[model samples]
Target: MTRRTVRIAMNGVTGRMGYRQHLVRSILAIREQGGLALGGGEVLWPEPVLVGRREHALREIAERHGLTEVATDLDAVLADDSIDIYFDAQVTSAREEALKKAVAAGKHIYTEKPTATDLAGALDLARLATSAGIKHGVVQDKLFLPGLLKLKRLIDGGFFGEILSVRGEFGYWVFEGDWQEAQRPSWNYRSEDGGGIVVDMFPHWEYVLHELFGRVTTVSAHVSTHVPRRWDEQGKPYDATADDSAYGIFQLDGGAVAQINSSWSVRVNRDELVEFQVDGTHGSAVAGLRNCRVQHRSATPKPVWNPDLPVTESFRDQWQQVPDNAEFDNGFKAQWELFLRHIALDEPYHWDLLAGARGVQLAELGLRSHAEGRRLDVPELSL
Candidate 1:
């Protein structure tokens, strides 16, 4: 079998998600597994060129992974025609410009959402990438989660006959830097630094709802910063300008309504940090990061409203756990392989830059809906 090496310029390896998920788990894991095999008996090997502002961090990552290529300048790396793809996991504010440069350099693009800080920039990038005839995609990792995969299996199998609605709860309390160093970066709470739950999570919700259930036709949202003040990375006090929580209601094409609450302030009481409960005419299911449980209409329990009496029925036990018939890989790694295959073998990939723009559009409209205190229509987008 012929082996083709695809060098990927991976930016933002210093960040939490970039380093752990993209660099270590996905790309390096692929290398350890002898690269990705294609349909035509060709193996597509991934070689990562680490790019970031900090040379020391990049070098450290290179040494840690036993990889050689490391660069502080993106333009210099992009100048090489051998660098086939540009992958961005940078901050939202810095993504658009870097993506633009990559597109201009005639490199295929893949990035973490929302792809840009706003819808316009996202659409612009989509248009540019399309015009340049370069392949592009955005990270929609949640869709590939084991739980979501089981949920998708049920959906495709008509288990959720005539789906009615979806309820999603996501997030956990992030410690303030004063008492404890925040799990997330301080920039996540600062609006100037492209921080906000709506902008950060609504993109994820958009793709999940769109791909799993139906296209979101309308949205209504309420957003707020529950923690008005928080300590930064340096133990400095600052006003939290971004919304730490967002409650959104979306209307889907099939008349299904989805309500999702995203927050950094709320404490998680559920089984997972993020979970979605989808209800249909014939059954219902609750899906989280790694597990999915379902209750068919035939087996659903009947309960009478009696808050005055102590509840005796074991409601949680009523649902059955969905079996995992197939082994699941890391969601980020899965998407990376697909993208690599798309570039190598012209494989079909629907989650392109345009799909990413749709996610940004949903976020923008959701924010507007919150500001206006009303539901807003979502228009179809085309380039």
Candidate 2:
């Protein structure tokens, strides 16, 4: 068996999503599993060096993770020709410049979305990577979620004949710093730090909708700041200028409409933090993070429109739960494995920097729709 090692310089890994999801769950877990199997009695081994601005944090993370290399100097790391890949899990605003440097350094690029704060920056990064002929990708992890995977299976099996609409309900209440500690970082609520629900979540929605249904051609949205002030990590109060919630209606290429609501202020009343309900001619399915419930046209129960009488039927019980027959790995890990294979073997990778640019483009257009009080068309993004 042939064992190939791919050295990766992981930057901004001290952040929450970076530390928990990418570093620990995804990368570390992959190493623990003896890297990603590349078939033909071969495997791709990932050697990641932790990099960050905080030396203490970087060294601590490396030591705790049993990693040998930790560096605060990103320029020095990038200059090392041994590093095949450069990963950025940094805050949204800081991503483009770092990615540009990585591209210039002749390293493959992968990052968490929005890729950049706006459409132009995201597209520029894509162009930069292409010009350098480096393998570049963006995180579109939602498409790999167990629930969505099950939904995709259903769609592929013709279970949902001629899909009509998709409704996504996402988000949970984030406590204000006055009474309780904020679940997310303080930067998430400040505009100067490139914070907003639309920029953060619309990217996920863009990929999910495009992959599951079709390309989103038009969008109408309303975005607003629900909570104006929150306490910071240091227990000091700060003004939150970014929008906390976004309500949007998107029209897909095939005329399917998708309505999504994302908020940090709303409390969870559904089965999960995120859920998507798809209605079609033959059946309807609702999928959460881990589970999917389906009601076929044959199995759907008829309802009466009696307002005076008390409702007796258990409407929710009519849907049948989708069985979990297959094991599902962490979505981030799944995508990471695919990206690693794409790099190691020069395999086909669909979610490149251009797709990420599309996500950023959708978010930018969504915000523009909010500001203009009109529907905006999503122009097709090409290389």
Candidate 3:
């Protein structure tokens, strides 16, 4: 059995999402699981080199993760001929330039979503990657969630005869610095750092709705800065310039309208921190991160409007839980494995930089819709 190693230069391994999700949960876990089995006695080994500006932090991460290689110089990493992939999990503001460099080096590129804050930059990266003939992908982790997978299965099984509409409620209270130390970084509340609900979340909604129903034809959005002032990491108050909440209405190509509310200001009243309710002619399903509940039209109870009487029937009891018949892996890791196969075995991979640009387009149009107080058309990006 011959095994091949794909050298991966991981940039921005110090950040929260990068460290916890991609490093520990995805790549490291892939390494621990004997790398990716490429079938026929061939294994795809992920040989990762930690790349970051802070030497101490990189060294600490390498030591903790049992990694051998660490590099502080981006130029050196680009110059390294052994590296086959350049992964960018850096902040939204710092992505394009580094990715361009990776493309110049002819490295397969993989990055986080909202590939760039603007559509042009994302398209430019796509152009460079295509010209270089390098495989590229953007992280669409939400598509691989257990609940979403189950929902997709039900949709494929025709549980929903004809999809009609969707409602998504996503948020939990992000504490103001006045009470408790904010869990999220303060930069998330600053627009200068590429932080805003429109930039951050509209991309997710774009892909989710498009995948579940159809392409998003039009968007009507209302975004706001829920907390104007928030305490920083050092306990100093700073003006939060970025929008912290968004209320969006997306019209799908299949005539399904999806309304999603994302907020850090609101308290939770739903079953999960994030949930999407899809209603159709035959059934309705509510999906969270790990669980989904369904209510068929036949089982639906007829509730007469009665403001004067206490409701006796348990509304929640009518819905049946969707069973998890199969095992699930980490969402990011699942995607990582697919990307590895794409590079190693020339597997079919569709989530490319062009797809990422579409996500950026959605956010851009969403912001425009909010500002103009009108619905905006989502133009398709054709290469």
Candidate 4:
């Protein structure tokens, strides 16, 4: 079998995720590693052309990554007969239109999550990609995290026995631009531009929950904009229209329950940068960003609860880090490699546009839930 190299034109190459994840992590890092491997020993490399708005910024990025092709126009890149894939890491608001154009030009697409801010638009993109016979993928990188991967192994191996529920604690204090002289991108704090934690992250949890446990049948959520305003990179004050915190609960397909708390306002006290704990009939396992600790039936604790009772520990120890079987790649890079494999080798990749649409559905429902002051049923949009 002849191995084919995938020529890529990366849109939004100047943005944060575009530069870091799609460009540096996926392109340069993959080059550093020779090639990106899919599950069945398939590998793909990017023959990349960087596209962005600013000439100097694009040139700097291209030079840093040793890429020679850099462009300031989308139409020029998309029209290029040589490119095989059009990668998008643009803001959520820009994805739908950009993806539509890419598909129309008959290029495969690998895009960042929340493929579209609206569920209907997301679904349309999926359908359009299918009709065009163009492969499309959305990044769902959390599934490849070492800690989350270990938790998944426990679930699949029946170490957790009959699964009960899962709790997810995600996020930390994003530096406010005022006092810390640091801030997230200006667009992230604005609602009109499709910036909100609910829209940005719920899709992540939606897929993670579906992959680790089961598909979420319904979701009930309350989202809040705790910090009403923030300063931009230039120290200009701006009203924050996006939610800074989100509290959500889901009922899985098989009656299992899960809850997720995502916020940018909290301080990190837990060792886990991201914590996911699954409780089962026979045992329980808690996973942090760096470790997964399991408490089997043999180590079950017997306790009496009292408000003033001092804490006693059993089955408590520093969770050992899951050993690496492969080279460590950041979340986005891992998924990018997988998508490239799916393109190059025709491998099975579950991170499709439909999966991306599911995430948008969850976020849209979460917003509706907050607005109506009631739980919104997760609706399946018919194609």
lDDT of each: 0.94, 0.93, 0.91, 0.83
Lowest summed lDDT across 10 adjacent residues in model 2 is found at 310-319
Candidate 3 regions exceeding 4 Å error are none
Against the true structure, candidate 4 has what lDDT? 0.83
Per-residue lDDT of 316-355 in model 2, one digit per residue for the tens? Answer: 8889999988999999999999999899888899899999
- What tens digits encode model 4's per-residue C-alpha lDDT throughout 257-342? 99999998889877776898888988887887657777777766676788798676643563334454555558777777777777
Higher-ranked by lDDT: 2 or 4: 2
Candidate achieving the largest lDDT: 1
Per-candidate TM equals 0.99, 0.99, 0.98, 0.93
Task: Pick the winner on lDDT between candidates 1 and 4.
Answer: 1
Candidate 3 residue-wise lDDT, 149-186, digit = tens: 99999999999999999999999888878779787888
How far is 54's C-alpha from truth in model 4 (Å)? 1.3
**Cα deviation of 39 in candidate 4 (Å)?**
12
* Residue pairs with clashing backbones, model 4: none
RMSD of each: 0.9, 0.9, 1.0, 2.4
- Which structure is stronger by TM-score: 2 or 4? 2
For residue 86, model 1's alpha carbon misses the true position, in angstroms, by 0.3
Error of 4 at 124 (Å): 0.8
Clashes of each: 0, 0, 0, 0
Cα RMSD (Å) between model 4 and the true structure? 2.4
